[model samples]
Target chain A: MKNNHPVDEEPPIEKPPFFNSWKGMYWLVLGNLAFMIALFYIITKIYE
Target chain B: MRPLDWIVLLGTIGFIVIYGIWKTRGSQDIEGYLKGDNSMKWWTIGLSIMATQASAITFLSTPGQAYEDGMRFVQFYFGLPIAMVIISVTVIPIFYKLNVYTAYEFLENRFDLKTRSLAALLFLVQRGLAAGITIYAPAIILSTMLGWSLTITNLVIGVVVIIYTMSGGSKAVSVTQKQQMAVMMGGMIIAGIMVVSYLPDNVGFGDAVAVAGKLGKMNVVDFNWDWKTSWDDRYNFWSGITGGLFLALSYFGTDQSQVARYLGGKSIGESRLGLLFNGLLKIPMQFMILFIGVMVFVFYQFNEPPVFFNEGTKSKLYATEHATELRTLEANYSSIFEEKKQAMQSLVSALKTEDEAAIAIAETKVENLNAAGKEVREEVKALITKAVPNAETKDTDYVFISFVMKYLPAGLVGLLLAVIFAAAMSSVASEMNALASTTVVDIYKRSINPNGSPMHYVNASKVLTIAWGIIAILFATFASMLDNLIQAVNIIGSIFYGTILGIFLVAFYFKRIKGNAVFFAAILAEVVVLYCFYFTEIAFLWFNVIGCVAVIVFGFILQTLIGKNEKELVKV
Candidate 1:
């Protein structure tokens, strides 16, 4: 919980959970967006 | 309000205010006061960011919007996740590297003092006005519905936010936001459950949703687009992805209110994770709120909805000379509801039977009756205009609150009211904190008194927080008399955001363009957007795109024209 790094220095970048790199995290977000859009599209067709 | 409702409302808001002050009581230095001493974790940053953006009008108007227009508004947030990715990859590191308090501090690092001051001033101008509306927009609606004085409602929101923000500054804002977000989401979820429970026993949850869909209120997506029509459409998929992206980028990227949220994070990873958390959850949160609206719409089908949702406005019609006419219209509305109620039953039965032809016939009957009901409502609005003269005729904003007052139990009514108050306080607190930090860091310290001690600056920040809070309260008080004031604040934000984003984009990516070129380009770009606002029929949302692109384009051209002098100057 203790933060040793000051604001001026590069704070240590930690690995994101479930992903080795930040790229996977970015894709997770984008992929979630795409999936939601598709799901919404399906809902539109079903209800409309 | 019942005594139980009053107790719940007061207890909820009082707990948040007292907890905010007490939890952050240790904050005394400038770093802690302005940026929470870089002590916030990912969840704190994420919730603070979401809470800051989710204003009182969001809680107050969004469901009403869904009741009238369906769920297409959720698309407006489509670009936010992408923007989060972009800012995380670029802007966060630069800001962290420079150790800036306000976002404009980075502009000075990247370009010149003039450019920094310019961005900061534009922010102050627009956000200062918007902070007032943040309090006023909800105050007007709450006061109207509750029959309380508008000034009292505004003061309650403004003064509570100021008390905590002034006492503990950024830490208080972030700490309290976690609770505020909980209240907002919890209150809405409970409201959603109550609405569903209020549906007729004959109608199951699936049946209610089907009814909503058949009536076209389940429209959650629209991919159809053409250049001519789509440019003006604000909430379609394409505009949402592109235009919404630019708007979010400007908002979360450059807007001090938002920047302050993540800038309080303990590390780069925490800030990045915080934004990504929002990107992933913000849409679903909006969808949940809009879905509650859809359910409210369906509930109205089996039950009688008020002919006009704003009972306050409708009541004004009774004292006027057109009172007789209004009574007749109400009669017509009641009869139409009877017919529509029967038609809706048939539609539900037909859907259950899975008979296409029967379904079509029932759907048509329901649609026709719905149209008739709509006509009666429109006539009532017209009558209200003629009869009350100055009454606001649009009732979409009143739909959800009216339902809560009319249907929800006493304790839940207080909880819902707490939800709105929590939302307003959360947003106002962030704006007050951000406004104070920007004034102190970007303007006061840099220009007026650079030699002040850290404690002196913290005191100055607390004073400025109170000052901005008072200004916002005053603005909200007077702004209620103006028409379309929310739209006015939004226009001001859009006009400035694009140019600010452009300057930041130039700073981050267009490194070849120096400070003077981009600064002038930003001014010129803002003028072009202003011209579009005043002269062209272009939608205001596009001003963000135009202003952003114009800055980069003009920055290039200006740099090319003055390359020799700039290069020489740089060498010197």
Candidate 2:
């Protein structure tokens, strides 16, 4: 049992593509969610 | 099936299976077998992740859901993108840190072996059954529609998956998924275009969509909730975000089928990127599927749809004493559809006129006819039950496939069928690979044979992959029809998902709760969730929330009491 977990060891840090930090990537996902919800809401109104 | 349709279907599946075998030919060690020796790039992992989740049921039932209920079903996935982000940020990094083979392995280091084993057992119980349903759900549908044997259809899906999955294991599942995803999306896009084009020459794309919207089929987002009534509402913004988030976390973070996808990634960045890709693309993909269903619903408005979609069930009804009654209902349905079709044409014209009053008038007429048609269909379902007591009565699952088989061109029919099979194989292959790796890494290699050579574990995994595939095929072969295919699978998932999610949540975030505490808590939480499922009127999605919260709360209380008792013992 290679017991090295719950280790909280930081992964070898590298810049994610098209983002300076991982934070940017996370925000992009969350932001996209917000935008999609808004866009869907608009579609619902326009259609219904 | 036409000869050309058969050619397209067979040629497509044959090439994918051969490609998967060729690409991942010589996986000699357990790491390469189970994790692809961490050689997968982000894009492959991303497509593989998407393919693994989009089983045949997604293609089959989703459009039907839209046809009957409208596009409000798309709201169910509102939480999934958020879920993808959560996994990418938190779950992926820890997995990379540990270099673990399965998600359960991290539990062993953080908790005790029992906790790890308990989680693994939970996964095996849930995913193993799910793998069977993955094949069975589609096979049963195809069998009834095409007059094929259910057993043969199940083997057709099961054997192909088992072949490639056993050949290269995890790498094979990923390698072939890229092709499967292409086929699934391409076939669906073509189907969507064909459906829209199949509308009468006068009905432009805009008119078709406008007509669908007017008919209340464009419902994509629902944000409102009532405290009393909304608790059991299956699809809404609130439930999707909260319950869907928990379910996705458990699935992607804890479930081996999904964990294996990203675990094969080349590095932390690759894994994270893979998940993010799914997050970005998954919702739109679902929207497209549901929208196609909406377009099909629109298509059926102009062209006369069958009184009953399940022709097989209807044929059985046709033989019974109720045949005359069924014929009468079909006549009524036809009479109502002829009027409804004209009303729909008027509605399209009204929409073109941009006259709100005229549009409202046409909409009411169409709604009335639609209601009349629905009542006739209900009468047909009731008649089916009276005639054939054992046959399945729900026809929504057949809505999309019936359209494809009856209306789409020959080669396109084959391509869409390939979409369904590719989706099934892609998902089944992933599950078999995941099941094998979990059985080997978590149970066999770790506990059963800790000192065995890498090659021995690799061989064991191959055997287990074939074994799981066979078991899935057997289960699919014998499984009876459920009420709704997609919901049946989701219900099974909801039953076990909450407790598994809770355990992983504790392991990942709640450091204070010891392994024993959370282990027992997970068991107790499972009991509570099952109680909710059987005893309460709670919606299935809420089970994810209920089980997760129960584990944390129960673990905390138990941990506190254990800490008190230990202190007293130390003082003595």
Candidate 3:
């Protein structure tokens, strides 16, 4: 069965999903945290 | 250097040329010539894109970078996969939808004629000069290492590339690139294995990494964000996401060299997949190359290497009066370097045992000793340069090739040389093709003759390819003057990529912005980016961010202000 949406209507703009969103600003913050955590882990391993 | 090796080198080169010409025999028209009649597959496009970006610089310098630094260089590519996904979804659909020849072609339709022209011109100048440097870079290595004349090396690179590029155009480039990529990957893997095999029997692969780790060559990732220090400039999360995004966007979305690669794709999905393929493979491929370099560094530590890696300069220096000074410096370097190597092994053992105090002691001594060894090597290299006035003394560029020559077997050496040649040829061929395409399509065909025959345009492209080939040779020869040829070309790109990207961004997003406003804004932004590059010490990567943002913000402001005034004045 066909949907009732108008043919000429503009499609909704999709947001970049929680992990990939916000000026990519949040993504940047989380990414830095992850990288630091990983780096420190490597350093600790290397030291050990 | 053996008869069989020579045979392999000549045979590989001969087959690529003949096969290329045979496959693309009748590609005489402009569309067939430049775009392979738009019938390439996804895998072919993916390989072609990889080949174009991985020039001889990748083979020659990346290992040197690894040997000097470590696997940390691999992090620079961390953002590439994500960048690829973004391009595939947003940028890919637009170009495919437009059915454009050059990426710049879409700018005219989206914005205005001037916008297209401005972007096209920027690509031409930057790419044309860079194409020369690529050709020149490999030639410098071949000539210096083989003790051949620079002129001969330059001509060989130019003539060999021109023959295939002019003969088969884009089709020849893509097909040959497939073979080239295979050979390059195979050769590098073998070279990496050979480095391990050449190690002392006591030092297995694990031990080598331990040795490398002790020497501080195993530090693959740096977390500190000290902006002022250029030495540890890892592609951080922010730079990778923001700057890398803009760079990938401008490069794939605008640059003709790359656009031409995908333009040959048969369908939109194929082209998009090809790009996605690159995004997947590039980071890991870079990691492998850097890892190979780390192994080379470990190999050198176990076996004493030359004071200066460039054998060409060492030979000339030995023949001169300054030989005595250089020899003394080398003797000093030999002893200190050995001690440093021992210190590295101790550090590794300390780390293995989880002895905190021993680790601290070993790390400090190892660092100090490593610093002293570097100082002595520099002093020796300086003496070598003083000994031979006219000799080219940059040894970092020669580190990998020197290893290849000293260690790799006879036939494998030829294969690796061919790999370097193939890498250089693939990149140079694409640049020549893209340069010709942009020249004929954007400037000549549009402005000079809007209705020229395909035959006529094809002929013009061949002529332009040869002309640019000559230009590249000249650039390649002089490229030695620059401290690092790879960095020099990249610096040039950083200056122009952002503004061009900005213009493209405005065309895609700013629906209300017209061509003239964006075009002028591009000009203004380019000047500012250049000023930042010259006057400021901001790392070259940051320039991409500055250029892209400046153009977008400036274009919008100019567009809105002019747009509003025009409407108000019209009402009056």
Candidate 4:
């Protein structure tokens, strides 16, 4: 099927510097957030 | 400020403005003026994005927010990374492919001209006022704290930003932001280190963190899931994820000030990398700023803090009929501070001894003392209100600056002041630049004089930049009426962002919905959001979610009705 969306034809798929793919980069970001939340939770528990 | 501080502040600002003008010289064409000729690399785009969002108020008020409310505010950005990932995948490529000047220009292609104009008008209204507030917020606080004339401070900030922004346009905003971000973060790091160093000799950084943690300043997340109370609560894990996600999507996806940053990028790849960079680093950057505030909180436990953070308001109370009462409150505050110091010392000692039971008891004592300190502070606030009813009584905005003036060494004071001014200029410059591009491209050239020459439109952009700069200055002059500068900016954005985001979402995902239905749905959704804001207890963050949802729901209904009418007309 022909792609109607012009942007989807040759999308920019250059990987970020460290990550192998964009998906990997996104996972790294989400993982970082999860780590931060866990660390904050631990801080809260230790203090409380 | 001392002579050294003045030189540091003025020299740093002078260098940035000149460099911006110099680097972006010869931007004769409209494309170069409006979009930096699509030449910016990812790092420049990233810092510009960060700089445009982190206004002086972020520097001035965020730490104070952390100092007073604890680190839970960091949770507010939990959804930002998610928003970044979504925008990178969806929004950036589309904008890059269209080669549009403003985000609104894409709306015209996707929907219709009126839809584009409506979105542009909404952005102008919010961002225009926000531009002024960016200048006014720091000007008011700095003038009062430093004994400078408020008018001079506002003009210095407004006119400097206007000159470079008008001269070089979008590239100027992007270029100067790199320098501005350096000064901002560097000064903050120095201030953070000084805060820890100023702690009592017996206490270390770990001890201070323990002290802050014990006193509830280390609270970075709250997963409490009570819907009954959650809607009214501003920041929590759930609200941050859901509400914050919506807000970030709207702001980064649709807001031209931000969109313009990456639209100036070299390619879709550069823009996407820039946004992903922001997503990854923004939370840590905010956490660091907030942690600096927590350190300041710990520092105040060892030393004496002012009864009222705003010296101007405190002085006004000193001269009024409530002078004696103010004096008594000051004494009471002093007594509470002494007791709090002793309690903190005991808490520190308990931590040193590693005695869990004693640590718990000491923590309670410190918490009680902190509560008592707050009560005395509230009494002081009441006295200030009684003395100067029209004055801004909220002191959290003043907390970080007050600490800087009192404790930081001489040259660092000037450096930090420069940080505030740089932050203010970086944000205001981006705003004025974005406002000008939208006015000239989306509204003026497109609507009024479609036949104007390229140079004519370019000059029109410059004229509009100056015009919007003036409007922002005038607005800043009258911005003192609002309390809590940072929240005021966000609330104004919230009131408008959801509807804008909804319009874009429908345009992107709902091919069946035509321009007419989505346009009216946007207007109706805005009214409903405003009603919720004025008449309900729904937290400001949720307004983003509500406004977006309302628009989508209304769009589907209106489109179905319109579709049925078209079918009936065919039968007739």
Candidate 3: pairs in clash: B132-B472, B136-B476
In model 3, where do residues sit more than 4 Å from their true spots?
A1-48, B226-235, B340-365, B384-393
Q: Residue-wise lDDT of candidate 1 within A14-47, one digit each (tens)?
A: 7788999999999999999999999999999998
Q: List candidate 1 segments past 4 Å from native.
A: A1-13, B481-490, B564-572
Ranked by lDDT, top first: 2, 4, 1, 3
Q: After superposition, how far is residue B245 of candidate 2 from its true place, in Å?
A: 0.7
Sort the predicted structures by DockQ, highest score first.
1, 2, 4, 3
- Estimated TM-score for each candidate: 0.96, 0.97, 0.90, 0.97
Summarize candidate 1's per-residue lDDT along B78-179 as a digit string, tens digits.
Answer: 999999999999999889998999999999988999999999999998899999999998898899888999999999899999999999899999999999
Instruction: Provide the overall lDDT of each model, using Cα atoms, as 2-decimal numbers.
Output: 0.90, 0.91, 0.78, 0.90
Q: Which clashing pairs does model 4 show?
A: none
Residue range B198-241, candidate 2, lDDT tens digits: 99988999898889888889888888999999999999989888
**Residue pairs in steric clash, candidate 1?**
none
Of models 2 and 3, which has the larger lDDT? 2
Worst 10 residues of 1 chain B by lDDT: B480-489
TM-score of model 3 relative to the true fold? Answer: 0.90
DockQ of 1: 0.39
- Which candidate, 2 or 3, would have the higher TM-score against the true structure? 2
Which of the numbered candidates is closest to the native, going by highest DockQ? 1
What range of 10 consecutive residues in model 4 chain B has the weakest lDDT sum?
B21-30
| Alpha-carbon DockQ of candidate 2 | 0.28
Q: Which ten residues in a row have the lowest lDDT in candidate 3 chain A?
A: A8-17
